[model samples]
Target: MFADARKIAELAWPVLIGQLAIIAFGVIDTAMVGRYSAVDLAALGLGSSIYISVYIGLTGILTALQPIAAQLHGARRYSEIGEEVRQSLWLALALMTIGFLILYFPGPVLRLARVPAALHERTLAYLQILAFGLPASLVFRVYSSLTNALGQPRLVMILQIGALLLKFPLNTWLIFGGLGVPALGGPGCALASITINWTLAIVGMLLLTKLDVFRELAIFSHFCWPVWRRQAAQLRLGIPMGLSYLIEVTSYTFMALFIARFGTTTLAGHQIAGNVGAVLYMTPLSIGIAASTLVAQALGAHRHEAARTLSRHGILMAVLIACCYALMLLVLRPLIIEGYTPNLQVAAAAMPLVLIVAFYHVFDSLQVTTAFVLRAYKVAVVPTVIYAVALWGVGLGGGYLLGFDVGGAIPVWLTGARGFWVANTASLAIAGFGLLIYWRGVSKRYLQVDAVGQVR
Candidate 1:
C-alpha cells in the first residue's frame, strides 16, 4: 500500500505542476487582456470558448495515444510506441486542418449562436488568428503524451514552463505594439499563442530526441504502411475514449454558449469562474493522469491487484485535494473573484457560481480519475457511454430545462450551469463504485482458479 501510494504521488506531482502552469498561462492572458480594455477582455472570453472547444475536443481524441503508448512501453514493445506516435501525429494534423478550415470561416456558425452583434467582428478576427495555432498545438500534444508515457514527465514540465514564460512577453509585444511591432490588440494574443505553440513543439521534439528511451524507438523513421495498421489498432481502441472526452467537454462548451445568450457580462463572469475551476481542477486532473499511467503499466505487467490498489490510492488523494480547494474557495471567494475582474456587477454575479464550482470539482475529480482507470484497462467504450448519458441526459437537459425554460433570468441561467456538474458527480460516483465491484469480481475469479489448482 505504501509503495503504491508513493508511486502515485511521484507521478502526480510533476503532472500537477505542469497542469497548473498551463492554467497560469490562460489566467495571465485573461489578466493582461482585462487590463488592456473591457471590450478586448470580452472578445477574448468569447473567442477562447471557441478556441478551447476545438482544441480540447481534438486533443481529447488524441488522448488515447498516451495510455496506448504507455501500455506498449510497459510490455517492452518500444518499436510499436514510435509507430503509435507517428499515427497520432498524422491524426492530429488531419484534425487540426479540419478545425482551422472551419474556424477560418466561422461566420455562419457564430451567427447561429445568437451572440451580440457588437462583439461579432472582433470575436471572428480573434478566432481566425487563433486557428493558426491548432496544427502546432496538436503536434505538441502528441509529443507531450509520448514523452510522458516513456516515464519522463519532468521533461514535459520543463518544456511547458518554457512556453508559459514566453507567452506573457510575446503577447505583450504583439498586442500592444511594443518592440517595433504594430498594435494587434486582441488578435495579438492569438499570434503569441501560435508562436508559443510552435516553439514548444520544436523544443519538446529536440529534448525528446535526447532521451535514450525515445531514441531507441527511432520515431522519426519513415512512416510504414504496416506500422499504420498497428496505429489504427490503437485508434480503434482509443477513439471511443476520445469520443467520451468530447461528449463530456462538449457539454460544458455548449453550456458556455448557453450562458453567452445572457450578455457579455454574464459570459465574461462565467469565463472567470470556469477558468478558476479549471485551474483548481488540475490538481485532481494530474492525479488522474498519474492513475492512468500507473494503472496501465500495472495491467501490462499483469499485476491486477496492484492496478486496483493504485486506483484506490489515486481516488483518496483526489478527494483530499478537492476538499482543500473547496475550503479555500469558500474562505476566499471574494478575493478570488475580484482578483480577476474589478467590475462590481460581474464580481457579485460570479460569487455564487464560484461556490457552486467548488462542489462540482469533487465529482469532476472522481469522474476523470475513474475514467482514466478504465482507459488504463482499455475498457473505454463503457465509460464513454456512461459519460454521454450522464452529461447530456442529466446535466445538460436539466440545465436547459431549469435555466431557460423555467427561470428565464441570467442569474438563474447561471445557476443552472451547476446541473452539469451535479450529473457529472452522480455518474462518476456510480462508475467509480461499479469499477470497484468489477475489480473484486475479477480477483475472485482468479482466486478460484488458483484454489482449484492447489487442490489438484
Candidate 2:
C-alpha cells in the first residue's frame, strides 16, 4: 500500500503542480480582470466559458496519446511511441482548425446566450485572440501527454509552471497599458496567454528533441504524413474522449451563459466559485492522470494484480485528499471569496457556492479519478454517454428548470445562479457513482484475462 501510494504520489505531485499552474492562469485572469471593472470581469467569465469549451474538447481528444503511449512504453514498444506522437500532432492540427471555426463563428451559442451588446464585442475579442493560440496549445497538449505517459511528468510540470510565471507580468503590462501599449482589459489576457502558449510549445519541442528520456523514442526524427488508418484508430478512441470533455465543459460554460442573464454580480460570483472549484478539482485530476498512467502501463505489462492495486489505491488517495481540501475550503471560504474581488455583492454571492463546493468536490474527485482510469483501459464511449446523460441532461437541464423557477417551486435561495451549482454537484455525484460501477466491471474483466492477455 505504501509503495502504491508512493508511486502514485511520485507521478501525481508534478501533475498536481502543473495542473495548479494552469489553474493559476485562470485565477490570475479572474483576480486581475475583476478589478478592472465588472463589465470586463463578466466578459472574461463569458469568454472563458466559450474558450474552455473549445480548448478542453480539442485537447481531450489528444489525450488518447497518454494511455496509448504509456501502454506502449510499458510493453517496451519504444519506437511506436514516436509515430503515435506524430499522428497525435496531425490530429491536433485538424482539431485546431475545428476549434478555430467554433471560436471564430460562435453564432449559435452567442445567439442562444443572448449576451448583452455592452459585453459582446469584448467577449468576441477575448475568444478571437485566444483562437490564434489553438495550434500552439494543441501542440503543447501533445507534448505534455507524451512526456507524462513516458513517466516524465516533471518535464511537463516545469514548463507549465514557467508559462504560469511569465503570464502575470505579461498580463499586467498588456492588460493595464504601459510602455506605449494601450490598456486592453480582458482581451489583453488572451494575448498574454497566446504568447505564453507559443513559448511553451517551442520549449516543449526543443525538450522532446534534445532530452535523453525521449531520445530513444525519436518523436520528431522525421515528419510522417498522416496515415488514414492510423488516424482512424486514434479517432476511434479520441472522438468519444473529446465528446465527454465537451459535454463536461459545455455544461459549465452554458451554466455561465444562463447565469449571465441574472446580472454581472451574479456572473462574477459564479466565476469565483467556479475558479475555486476548478482549483480544487486539479488534485483528483492529477491523481487520476498519474493512476491512469500506471494502470495502463501495468495492463500493458500484463500485471493485472498490480493494475488493480494501483487503481484502488489511486482512487482512495484522490478521495482522501479531496476531503482534506473540502475541509480547508469550509474554513477558508470567506477569505477565498474575498481574494477574488472586493465587490461586496460578488463576494456574498460566491460564499455560499464555495460552501457547496466543500461537499461536491468529493464526488468530483471520484468521477474524475474513475473516468481517467477508465480511459487507461480505452473505455471512453460509455463514459461519454454517461457524461452526456448526467452532466448535460440532469445537471444542466435540471439547473435550467430550477434556476428559472420553471415549475415555480424553487426556494429563493436555490432559484438563482446558486441552483446551477447545486445541480452540477448532483450531476457529479451521479457520474461518480456511475463510473464507480463501470470501473468495477472493467477491473473484473481485466483481472480475468489469461496469460496471453485474453479475457476468460
Candidate 3:
C-alpha cells in the first residue's frame, strides 16, 4: 500500500502543482479585472465562461495521447511513440481549427450571455484574441500529455508554472494600461494568455530537441503527411471523451443560467460555491491523471494484476483525500466564504451551499478518478454515454425539477439554487458508482483469464 501510495504521490504532486498554476491564470484575470472596472469585470466573466467551455471540451479530446503513449512506452515500443504523437498533432491541428472558429465567431455564446450592447464588443474582442491562441494551447496540451505519459511529468509541471508566473505581471500591465500599452481590459487578459500559449508551445518544441528523455522518440523527425488510419484510431477514443466533457460542462452551465432567475445574490452565492469545488477538484483530477498513466503502463507491460491494483488504489486514495477535504471545508466554511466576498448577503447564501459542496466533493472525486482509470483501459464510449445520462438526465433534469419546484413538491430548502446543488451531488454519486462497477467488470476481463480460460 505504501509503495503504491508513494508512486501515486510522486506523480500526482507535480500534476497538481501544474494544474493549480495553470488555473491561476484565470484567477488572476478575475482578481485584476474586478479591480480594473466593473464593466470589464463583467466582460471578463462572460468571455471566460465561453472560452473555458470551448477549451475543456476540445482539450478533452486531445487527452487520448496520454494513455496511448504511456502504453507504448511501457511496452518499450519507442519507435512508434513518436508516430503516435505525430498523429495526435494532426488531430490537434484539426481540433484547433474548430476551436478557433467557435471562439472567433462566438455569436451563440454571446447571445446566451445576453450581454449589454456596451459590453458586447469587449466580450467579442476578448474571445477573438483568445481564438488566436487555440492552436498553441492544443499543441501544448499534446506536449504535456506526451511528456506525462513518458513518466516525465515534472518537465511539463515546470513549464506550466513558468507560464503562470508570467501571467501576473502581464495581466497587471495590460489590464491597467501601463508600460506604453493601452488598457485593453478584458481583451488584455486574452492577449496575455495568447502570448503565454505561444511561448509555452515554442519552448515545448525546443525541449523535445534538447531533452535527452524525449530525444529518443524522434517526435519531430520529418513531418509525415497525416495517416488517415492512425488519425481515425485517435478519433475513436477522442471524440467520445470530448462529448463527455461537453455534456458535463453544459450541465453546470445550464444550472447557472437557470439559477440566475432566483436573483443576483443567489447566483453570486452559487458561483462562489462552484469555484470552491473547482479548486478542490484539482487534487482528484491530478490523482486521476497519474493513476491513468500508471494503469496504462501496467496494462501495456501485461501486468494485469498491477493495473487492477493501481486502479483500486487510485480510487481509494482520491476518495480518502476528498473526505479529509470535505471535513476541512465544513469546519472552515465561514472563513472560506469570507475569503470570497465581504457582502453579508452573498456570504449568507454561500454558507449553506459550501456545506453542500463538502458532501458533493466525495462523489465528485470518485467519478473523476474512476473515469480516468477507464480511459487508461482505452474505454471511453460507454463512460461518455454514462456521463450524458447521469449528468444531463439526473443532474440537470433533477435540478430543474427541484430548483424550480416544477411539481410543487419541493420544500423551501430544496428550492432555488440549493436544490440544484443537491441534485448535482446525487448525480455525481450515481456516476461514481456506475463507473466503479464498470471498471471492476472490465478490469476482470483483462486480469482474470486469458482467451483459453487460464488465469492471466
Candidate 4:
C-alpha cells in the first residue's frame, strides 16, 4: 500500500505543479487586466468563464484517450495506443469546430448572461481571439492525455511550466503596450494565451518525434483515416464524460450568477471563498489522475487485484489529506480571508463561506478522486448521472430554496451566499459517498469477472 502511495505521489506532484502553473496564467491575466480598466476586468471575467466552459466540455471528450491509451500501454499493445491517439485527433478537430463556432459567435451566449452593453464588444473580441487557440489547445490536450495515461505526465508538466514562464512577460508586454505593441487591455490577454497555446502544441508535437520513448510508439508513423467504429467507442465513454464536466462547470457558474443577486460585497466574498476552494481542489485532482493512470494500467496488465487495491489507497490518501487541509483552514480562517481582501465587510462576509470550504473540501476530494478512479474502470456514464443528481438537483436546487428564504422556511442567518455554500457542501458529500459506493461495486464486479476467468 505504501509503495502504491509513493508511486501515486511521484506521478501526482508533477501534475500538481503543472496545473498550478496553468492556473497562474489566469491569475496573471486578472491581475494585469484588473489594473488596466474595470470594464476590461469585467469583460475578462465573462469571456474567461465562457471560454472555460467550452474548453472543459470539449477536452473531456478528448480525455477518453487517457484510459484507452493507458490500457493499451499496459497490455503492451504499443501500436494500438498510437491508433487510438490518431482517432482522438480526428475527434478533437470535430469538437474544436463546435467550440470555435460558439466562441466566435458569442451573441447567443452573451444574451443569456444579459451582459452590459459596455462589456459586449470587449468580451466578444476576447472570445473571438481565444477561438483561434482552441484547435491548438485541443491538440495539446491529446498530447497531454496520451502522456498522462502512459505515466509520463512530466512531459506535459514541463511544457506547462514553460508556457507559464512565457505567460507573465507576454501578458505584461501585450497588456501594457510595451515593445511597440498597442495596449489591447483585456483582449491582449487573449492574444497572449493564443501565442502560448500554439507554442506548447507545436513544441509538444516536435518532442514526440525527438524523444526515444515516444519514438518507440511511432504514433505519427502511419496515417489513420477516421474510423467510425473506434470513434463510436470513444464517444460512448466520452459523451458522458463531457456532460459530467459541463454539469460541474455550469453548477458553479449558476451558483456565482445566483449569488450575484446579493450585491457586490457578498459576491466578492463568494469569489474569494471559491478561489480558495479551487486552489485546494488541485491536490485531490492530481491524486485522482495518478491513481487512474496506475489502476488502468494494472487492469490492462490483467492484475485486477492490484487495480482494486490502487483505487482504494488512492481515495484513502486523498480524503486523509483533505481532512488535514480542512483542519488547517479552520485554524487559519481569519488570516486566509485577510489575504484575499482588506475590506472588513468583505472579510466578515467571506468568513462563513471559507469555513464551509473546510468541510466542503473533504467531500470535494472524495467525489473528485472517486470519479477519476471510475474513469479508469471505463465507467463514466453512471458517475456522470450521479454528479447531475447530486450537484445540479440537490446542490443548486436546494441552494435556491435556502439562499432566498423561499417559503420563509429559512432563518435569516442561512440566507444568501452562506446558504448556497452550506447547500453545496451537503451536495458534495452526497456526490462523494455516492461515487465511492458506485466505484466499489464496479471494481468488485470486475474482480469477480476476473476470478471467473481464472477458474475457467
Candidate 3: tens digits of C-alpha lDDT, residues 301-353: 88888999999999999999999999999999999999999999999999999
TM-score of each: 0.86, 0.90, 0.97, 0.99
Q: Please identify model 1 stretches exceeding 4 Å from their true place.
A: 114-118, 221-223, 226-228, 257-273, 331-352, 404-456
**Range of the 10 consecutive residues with the lowest summed lDDT in candidate 3:** 447-456
Give the least accurate 10-residue stretch of model 2, judged by summed lDDT: 447-456
Cα TM-score of candidate 2: 0.90
Q: RMSD to native for every prediction?
A: 3.8, 2.8, 1.5, 0.9
Q: Which segments of candidate 3 are over 4 A away from where they belong?
A: 449-456
Best by lDDT: 4
**TM-score, structure 3 vs. true:** 0.97
Candidate lDDT (C-alpha), each: 0.76, 0.89, 0.91, 0.94
Q: Is candidate 2 or candidate 4 better by TM-score?
A: 4
Candidate 4 local lDDT, 115-162, one digit each (tens): 989999999999999999999999999999999999999999989998
- Model 3, residue 108: what's the lDDT? 80
Model 1, span 321-404: residue lDDT tens: 788888999999999998989999888767767877887777777777777776777777667777777777766776666556
Q: Candidate 1 — number of clashing residue pairs?
A: 0
Better of 1 and 3 by lDDT: 3
